[model samples]
Target: MTLPDLDPDLAKDMQAIEIRIDGENRCLAAGKVAMPEIAKGEVLVRIHAAGVNRPDLMQVAGMYPPPPGASEIPGLELSGEIVATAPNVTQWKIGDRVCALVTGGGYAQYAAVPAAQCLPVPAGLSMTEAASLPETFFTVWHNVFDKAGLKQGETFLVHGGTSGIGTTAIQLAKAFGARVITTASTDEKCQACLDLGADIAINYKTQDFVEQVKTATNGKGADVILDMVAGDYVSRNFKAAAMEGRILIIAFLNGPKAETNFTPLLLKRLTLMGSTLRAQPVANKGAIAGKLRQQVWPLFENGTIKPVIYQTLPMNEAQAALDILRGGAHVGKVVLEVP
Candidate 1:
């Protein structure tokens, strides 16, 4: 893996967000830390913006923690200029703008990321927009396209139509010729989903998404379902899936456990699967980056896709950004700009 070179001022300290843990209590603090040194096959990014995600909220609540050997910071994705690179890296260089998926350390002003996990920022996207891309885009692409094999003309159903993941999935599925159906909590969010190319937007607050999906499909049901709310939705997903449908679980906002009959597994030939990107090996994430660069980046460059940003705040307001995410009131991504 030949990568371009970058040189950072390692002598200077950098400002970073600290997760000060006291017993079961935790708080965010802005403090100074020594610059991170790049490792083999890694590059250091001078973060311009960091995308806040639900996992960051979960980390604050002690429900999620960074994988071993990862930074204690809570951010999962970032876009910035490459300032330093490891001795052997030759694919990225100083001043190159890129967006990367990281296990942690994205909340900080600087983060060390594997060279292969980085993708050049799309042609017309700002750093904040690019920051919003990595986490949700990678997750949707991997689960929907790579794992579930959602083909053109298939029915793709996703819950949380206003979420970062939901928005990305709707556009990508529709772009790739799939029929997108999504559920949102409000009528406005449902409209937002439709504007993003969803064929049908079900207001789950007032309607039964399962029945709506069935009716919209003429009882054929959805060919693929991306579920973030587990709990009872697990069984309901089985009911909503088409013959030999694939159901992908990416998160458990509604809880993980479900008491459901296993009959659907055999009867409908449905496949239920889930994955978390944080703990994946560098090589695994690198593979996903390559595919995104080749397949999806062009969509951005050609203006076939646009990032949906709900809010952007400065780095010191990290806690406020997380609160907005926790409240689930926003339509798309909330990001922090590093000064």
Candidate 2:
């Protein structure tokens, strides 16, 4: 496909149809937000799509704030073509189809991202699918593999088994040879997780996940657990984890406060760790991006792993997309298709 001719003035001051927060509501509004300036080692992307994530919702509710020096816009992942590049950026050029993990500002029609944070769109993925990859894949990779060191042949348990993060974790862990167990709210969602390659799917509404994990692992317990619902699960996870187990907390969906027995920490020799991706340093995210390019990208290329999108809404309907996520009924990612 031939690229469009660039009108310098239009490129200089782009129209980003952004979601503005009104009192207790988020509404889409077209505004002339300044086109991001590319610093050294950065590239300007004419975004085709942007991913809507839980953090984006938090930001909309004013519970989460963008990091200092990051864009105030509420998107974390994007798929687009490179329109311009900084002088120091040689790895990418104009017209490259790339998906990136951005700190912020991806909700716009254009985004400026670090060269190191961008990866080529995998073969056979649509721009919307590619847009869905970065945030979930990066979060799963950093938490499950990097922080927890989830090994092959181990039992991996994840909460919210039908979420963007859950779907990515299930596929990646399965691809890498781990036996995955995930918990969901309904039998339908549980089946969805099973279809995504989970070995065991627990319907948390009906079954106690601790008992399910115990039965699945023959009372040895899960070797590693990726927990998003950390409130009460914090205590229950300790009970479900094996000796020398690792638990990585990415979010507290239920609530953060919890009263748990600390004896398991000593008895199981378990490691409990938590991280928020957006607040991490650029270097850290860049490093994770590089690893994803090398290790995980092949899985996408070979069809061993792919994003499961629940719905694609036009960028102008971002709030509607977010509402789907808030309902927690969607099985995978909710993507915003940019026009």
Candidate 3:
């Protein structure tokens, strides 16, 4: 079938929401802007939706911005149709529906993504659902699987088990044969995580997660702990981690700096690593995308690993969408549909 001609530059220029800094919530006006050019190994995409993330909220709050060499616009991942490709980008063709992990610039109607970082959208998912995949999925996959080296039959603990990364990790770890344990604040959220294949769902607000994990794991502790809350969870994560276990810290939603006892970590012979998806280099991100496509995409295609969408909002209401994300009430991914 012949594909419709799509000029990404023109599309981006014609459609985009402008966000300007102010004391209160910033303004997101619809206006034209220049679309980025396709660089080496890059493909220009006509974005259909961009996932609203916590980092986007931080950017608007003047705390987080795209790392050096990335676009100033606020977005981390997007799903769209390929419009143009730079030389040597042979893997995709025009009109191919794809989702890509981007450092930034996904908030626009058109964005340039490194060709290698693009993954074919799995069948039976809308662009909005697919848009939610890259940032959270990639982040979880890299930290839980690659960095922490979680294996089948092992026990894994994930903090914030109802958030985007948490939900994705729960499903993926279970599908891959790991025993999942997760912590959430509310009973509903804990039940949701349990339903998503978590073997143990602890309501952190009501119970001590570390003690519960110890009891659940026969006093051995978990094989891995994926932590986003770093303040108090840091020491507890070490305590809950098993001998020779690995702890991967992805985000400090509570706070980055923490004073914690390192004795348990050292005694357990644990490996602690902290990582972020957005600040990673393009090549590294591309490699992760490729690996995820090869290993995890099949699970998604088979309906084993699904994108859990909590809500969808119009791109124009980006601020409200971000506010909801920051509120932490959602159980899964929140997406924003673009024009």
Candidate 4:
């Protein structure tokens, strides 16, 4: 089979299948969307694979809206070869294999990503595995390491241990010399977390995570807590955190509103912070990309860490991929492989 040539004139308008929402229904449809143009600092990527994330589901459900000036499409990360570069772009050129953390527009055949957001595909990783890296890795790097200040020899707790973010967090914290504790819903999922380098995997259905954290840390509690299920977990995480601990909230899967006592904040000297990556400035995301390249990309290159893909469906089967994610049955990322 011959690979398609990257010709700007011929690629002006390509066959880009995009997912569109019909009333309350979301479905993938064939359409002729204009090929993205390279901006001053952007590179046009011929996307081979795109990673599906929880934020995409929220966008499909009409809950999360794309930031101003971002692509209305729902994907957040992708791996592909560079097909074109903006005149000002010097770091990358056509035919470079790269993966990028995009703000939007990753569900199509091509995406115009900021040059700074793109990184060389790690040594010995397929497009599918590389595609799975950016979203979860970026989120975890920012929340767990940057904001939470997770240090070596500390006890770190992550909720939803079987999730893409959870698995990434477990591996990254362990790689940085932290003891990781994670919570999953089932025995099998708990074992999966343990297999992924978690020092302790709590079956949240059978045990209270706060109690488990306290017990595992010998009453010192977790030094850092990466939380996605915030609602009631906010109060519970407060109970599980050690003195001067940090609690970073990236999502509120249950509900954002929480009723928590301020006494813990005052007495424990704890710090609470939250962030949504998509809405952050491009420069900030670019800085994060730089850090990942320097600090985390080597992990993938040397096989010290790897993406755990639960399933890979054709790009046309994007809805099915989202269904698997919504059902919470997947142990890791659900990726969409583009032809």
Candidate 5:
């Protein structure tokens, strides 16, 4: 694999992972792609690391595609030093270390990211840990804190307690003074959730989460629920929510289809909402970056909250990284190092 030159060669090709589909299988193979151009308000990053995510798997399987004008290569988050900057960009100059949220093209030696969507790597973290932050942190902060308005002293519940999003949500919610509850597939994973500061951790495989939540909250139910498994969990979430509760959906790993009853929603006065960050406007994502920098970055700086990286693989092993993510046995973030 060729590393970028001492000075970036923006006109040349760069190594990246490309999707090759044959029959029912989608393979991540190595290839060369042209270096991305830095548009106005954008900067070209010499990517040190890129975070693997479920969306990358979905894109490889043809279930998800890059939005219009996005690069065909798949990666949602990355950390690196700025190699070049757009003429109009001022906040991030060449040589700045930043982690950014991108619509696409993160699985490469270089990615062009909007300046507003980039946040400085927190003081104590490595590039691999910084790469892990943009996606889960942004999603959790937006859905759980910004949208759901999870308040201090409120009870918060998140499914998939060992997932990248789950670990992030657990730590963030705990740091903000919320009582956290999370559900995982195993007793060990439940213990992992408890270690992340969750007040309660339910093993959904052996236990009925609805019952556990009721008992934990003393029959009042959780004040806010962050759900990624939506199928039957939809109705279950409705049952686990408190009166005037908020339920935010970010993904549907159990399948998006569900047979849901609306009676509980009406009776419980539950507010159901969902969002995806990739397709949102750059301004919206930039605003989220600002919030994380101002509100969440301090947590990292002070060691109150930290990114949890389960594994790191070479950039060329992106498929292996995705395989680890697909298998669902891993905890926290899986990252790919460019060098």
Candidate 6:
């Protein structure tokens, strides 16, 4: 098939994987769909790999849908080589390898990404490792540093420390000289967080994270908290949070709806904020990509921060990939290679 000639620098040949709903509890995966047309200010990417995320699973379950004007495909991030670029864009070429934060459509053989939302893949990282960076890293960075304003010597609590976002948050916070406290369910998961530079790892299954955190900090409480589990953890997080603290909510793995007292928030001068990548505008994603490339990419390039890949599965074996993520047996990222 002849793809649209949207970018003079883009290769004419491209392909993609698509997700279509078949019925309840069944998702039909379509492979080798036609390459996407490059819209204005967008570039066509020859996607090498894509990161699997919990949000993708939510979309598959019909609990979430792509935000307005976003791609219908479920993926949120990808790493790939540039195949084409539209007019008025410079500073990138057809062969540059990059990891991008996307609104959706990373689960494909090819994707069209806004030029401003793309970051050059670090020099030493492989496509699999690079593919793991975008969604988790960007989410953590925005919530922890940009929104929460975490500072040096402050204690930051991260839930799900063995998951992709959890591990990434631990390293990034440590890299910036912040103290990290993470909660994991298993002993091994707790150790994994410690190995990644977290100051303290709490096994929430065996102990109460709030008490552990308070005791660890000499009763001062955590300066900032990054929580994905919002149900019961909400009250516990507030209890463990320090005066004038900030809590950033990125996901609700346990549950979204919660009943909590507002007195603690008012008395402690705490700030509560929530964000999601799929729901944000292109400009915001572009700005994040630019900042991460300038600030965080060097750490990746210099070996300060690296992707912790758990497994890789070919794109065709998507169900197996989903099963692995759903099983929650692995740490770090589970990547799907297009090749």
Please, what is the TM-score per model?
0.96, 0.96, 0.95, 0.96, 0.97, 0.94
Q: Give the runs in model 3 whose Cα sits over 4 Å from its true position.
A: 1-12, 23-28
Residue-level lDDT tens digits of model 5 in 1-339: 222334445458889999988899888998888878777788889999999999999999999999999998999999999988877888877789999999998899989899999999999899999999999999999999889999999999999989999999999999999999999999999999999899999988899999999998999999999999898999999999999999998889989899999999999899999889899999999999999999999999999998888999998999999999999999899999996
Q: 199-243, model 4: which lDDT tens digit per residue?
A: 999999999899999999999999999999999999899899999
For each of the candidates, the C-alpha root-mean-square deviation to the true structure, in angstroms, is 2.3, 2.4, 2.6, 2.7, 2.4, 2.6
- lDDT leader: 5
- Judge candidate 4 at residue 290 and give its lDDT: 93
lDDT of each: 0.91, 0.89, 0.87, 0.90, 0.92, 0.84
Check candidate 5 and list the clashing pairs. none
For model 6, residues 299-336, the per-residue Cα lDDT tens digits are 98787888998999887777677788889988998999
Clashes of 5: 0
Q: Name the regions of candidate 2 deviating beyond 4 angstroms.
A: 1-5, 19-28
Candidate 1 lDDT tens digits, 226-267: 999999999999999999999999999888787889898789
Better of 5 and 6 by lDDT: 5
Stronger candidate by TM-score (5 vs 6): 5
Across residues 1-339, which tens digit of lDDT does each residue of candidate 2 receive? Answer: 122366767566776656577777866566778778788788889999999999988887788889899988779999999988888888998999999999888888888899989999998898989999999999999999999999999999999999999999999999999999999999999999999999999999899999999999999999999999898999999999999999988889879899999899889999999889888877899999999999999988888988899999888788788899899999999999887
After superposition, candidate 1 runs with Cα above 4 Å error: 1-10
lDDT measured at residue 200 in model 5 versus the true structure, 0 to 100: 94
Candidate 5 has a TM-score of 0.97
Better of 3 and 5 by lDDT: 5
